[model samples]
Target: MSALLLDTAPLRSSPEYRRLWIGLTLAGVGSQLGVTAVALQVYELTRSSFAVGLVGLVSFVPLVVLGLYGGALVDAHDRRRVIVLSSAALLVASVLIAGQAWLDVGSVVLLLGLVALQSAAFAVNSPARTAIIPMLVPVEQLPAANALGTLSMNLGVTVGPLVGGLLVGTVGFGPAYTIDVVTLLVALVTVLSLPPLPPLGGARKAGLASVLEGLRLLRGWRNVRMTFLLDICAMVLSQPRALFPAVGAVLIGGGATTAGVLASSVAVGSVLASLVSGPLGRVHRHGVAIAVSVAAWGAAIVAFGLVLLLASPSAAHTGSVTSTAVPWASWHLWAACTALAAAGAADAVSSVFRQTVLQSAAPDWARGRLQGVFIVVVAGGPRLGDLVAGADADALGEALAAVVGGVACVLAVVVLMAWQRGFLRYDARDPVP
Candidate 1:
């Protein structure tokens, strides 16, 4: 547990934190539903892997464009209001999606476009949302607060897609989106009731100047820069999620249902890991924990690929008839689950430190901006991986793509950790701010 959480565990006893957690949890579920809707809908309509991949492309561009500005806006405005406004925007997009499905008017371009708008709205929401955490909980309890938040989020995300896949597969798209809208409204109403969180370090009059100013601070802070860079490489190199469906159908031979099960398993692993992280909270060292955690993540991914290899070599040999398709069976599917679960759990441990480092290292005045950039890499890296790995899935094969990403991630983490002497030496006792 980070100092923020352990010292402040008594504070989480407050009603406000409970409400905030509940609200965010419901909204997290809704958001995951919306995400799953886009991917599954796109794939269903176009039946093209590339079109499915474009979902990330659509979401990423707007999110990247609005991200820094959103951070500045969060710094410049009320955190609660920003979250409410952004949640409302997301609701509108959800309503729009529901309407599209209701009318039987489905255009992949239009769907992607609306999903992009929702992404933009969400882009505005996160910085304020993250910045609000310190206000809701004491600084000392922030890590525990964060740990709880992670548990809720992982639960929502894991269950959302599994339910969503079943819903989209059975109940139809209209209901899936409608559920998201209801959840968002709940989140909005819950946030509206919280006590006011004053702007950190007084509001900077909002402008590009503030954004650049935030950037300047992060640049000068060596620990923040180094940890974030390692995060980027770690995420970019080994994100094999885009290939899950393909792997389910081709490599594992269970199809979409299997994909959902496999996909949900990753989040299950993350949730289980976090739930059991009593020891992860006690670590005193930042650099060693982060480096080792991420390297474990990379190695787990490689282990995942190797499992695929061991499952069925004949999986790659396709026949025109479905009967001739080689069956990799479900045990390999279980192995993939084990590997991904380990990866998610390790990554979660890594996340606690990374967030701690960023908050401790950056001046509170500029934490939102640094977090905004952090959000960008956090969100953006997956999309980048989708493009890279999705294309590779077409050209090479899903198993091979997983292997490729795994190798790159291991090398990147080792090199980055070796070079970032500053991050390794950072002490939490003396906060950079």
Candidate 2:
């Protein structure tokens, strides 16, 4: 096997990481189902794109606010216990949703509220989980550990939405929610099997102080700060999944099926890339690797938007960019799918390096807290991207918004590469502490 694949082996070899990976993947599947059901139910009831956005928005504050404190808590407390509590909360929330569904008393308001609760539970659980990885595997294997996490996320992201949409459409929301409950229960067993994680030695108490400490540490490192900023920019600007339903209906004309297909495409790319990512094990210049991958993502997205403009039929909706020459199959949907997939593949590469950088750089005591913040940023990014894409799609157009976002992603990465000399110049072999 290539070194990249072998590097990840250390992570795969760890029994505890393996168990957590499986559990989290299953839980993620359930969560996505609940999300799809809520969005479907909200749109069906209120018949408003705004309501769908609201479902995402409602989950935001809980995820952000709790994310920081929760990470700090992860640093100060037992990680295994935190995972248990988070899982338990998610389980209860899933049960509540299932009960309401079974009783046929579904309320959009109630569903949104429950989603917020589940997100908050996840807020606590996510950081502890991220923090625990270093403990489970040796230091050099951190990149592989991160790759494993990304792989699971890609699988869950792609499969979960499709399954969630299918289950809701076929058997009603009850079955959709119940599946999550069952999966979550199965995940709980994984958590139960984990050994206790004592707090890292010399970790500070959890509070605003800890939050500030995390912020300070993250900012002190020029690369980390820029990385976090770049993530925010790319996510808040160019994410296209939020606009998928509208695009499927108005642009591609396939409804939920198309949306599912489109949604899964990005994950498809990521999974495929990661599967062959054994090459990643050989690279040492992780910073340059991250910067270049992000730039590639920008180019891919821009190309996707170009697909829309180049197709004649899409040109009609997008105001005659292609002029009735190109075939229908060569239109907006195909382009979007292609670009999103490319972006996903590139992101997986960047993620492996970024995770490695942080794992190696972070102080032992503060690792959990910092990781918690990272998880929060990572999780909440898509929602922000959704809102941004949705708003822009209303004012400008979906095609235009995607194009702009892609350009922005490219520009941002280029700027970061130029500015963060230390990050770009840092040697992986010798390391920089």
Candidate 3:
């Protein structure tokens, strides 16, 4: 039973890690609340889903542009100081968001600008925080530590939007944003307590040269590079999120509510997987584990697509009726959710190993920059997946699109494994990056 449960060894072994984990979890929830509030406010102000989507665009741009720079900054300075400044920037952004809402400024541009600032801060803050984990915990415990991190993130994803919606709908955006401000402050205080983490050898100047130096490490490090490639395969080729709205309305008959349920199912699976990830820390063939997990994700997605096909004969056609209430008794809905949950679990497992490999294998000086790139791949891959999934659904029907994507993802993994045979033999005990 202990082997099957989540390993709390990392938390028990390191007080600093425990405090940092708690702070990150709270701040993650708060960040989600702010995201939900901002999206809702945009919709209320403009009544346009497209306008709401612009929020993602603004956020993504800064994250991509600054993510590497942030990592460079981490490598160049005391990581603790970098985190403190960036977290302060996040708090200031949250305060402005709340102020604007309270003042009834009602400007879409202003709201977007604030979101960009928050995203830029996050771009810097995340890499520094992630890079510090190795410094705080034992090498053998990296997987467990990463699993805990993933658990917290998924928890925020699972809980934040629901609470944010309630707060915004019942009260107003101000209260939601205000709560975020409080959470950010907590995060800031926790970071302040962390000891100075100066660069080990000597700090490189944080500039384009430093950033490019970090990027160059990827060229020589095949194992670390494979981690990014596998993740991209899983997220880009097999991700089925964009198809949720159509799947709920037409094949599943649940409408927007159904879409919400389907979307949340993934996070639920992630949380459950994290809870039972104790055995993952003992595994040594991390590369093989990553491949198998990604393959499982593809298989689960394929199962989800088949369930959709089985549920409705007219699934390929457009203009179907959408329902308000979920058909709780329907086997198709249950099956589809189960498949999505499985995919989520596989994804969570893959993520633990991937992060462990990156953190364990990369040199400390380059960890921050690599983590920045990791953040970019993590954030950007899903958006690209949305575009790919949407295009495929439009041309080939959602069910077939999903089927094609799953197949593609599995095939891509196979090809990658064949090309980099060494990746399959990568042992965690002797990390090679």
lDDT of every predicted structure (CA atoms): 0.73, 0.74, 0.82
Where model 1 places Cα greater than 4 Å from the true spot, the runs are 1-11, 310-329
Q: Which candidate is the best by TM-score?
A: 1
Q: Which pairs, if any, clash in model 2?
A: 4-281, 315-320
How well does candidate 1 match the true structure in TM-score terms?
0.91
Summarize candidate 1's per-residue lDDT along 1-433 as a digit string, tens digits: 3423223352347677788778878988887877776676666675555666677778788877778888888888877888888888988988898788778787988898898888899888877777777666666665566667667778886887777666665667788888888998888898888777768668877788988897788668877777777777667778776665556545665444555666677688778866766565566677778777788888888888888877663545331111223244657877888998888887777777788777666666787787788777777777766777777777777777778888887788778877766667666666553
What local lDDT score does residue 48 receive in model 2, on the 0 to 100 scale? 50
**Model 2: runs farther than 4 Å from truth?**
1-8, 100-106, 308-332
| Candidate 3 lDDT over residue span 190-290, tens digit each | 87888888877879899999889888899999999999999999887877866765665567765444554666677789999999998888889999999
lDDT of 3 at 159: 65
Q: Judged by lDDT against the true structure, how good is candidate 2?
A: 0.74
How much is the lDDT of residue 87 in candidate 2? 84
Stretches off by above 4 angstroms in model 3 are 34-57, 95-114, 165-179, 242-260, 308-333, 390-401
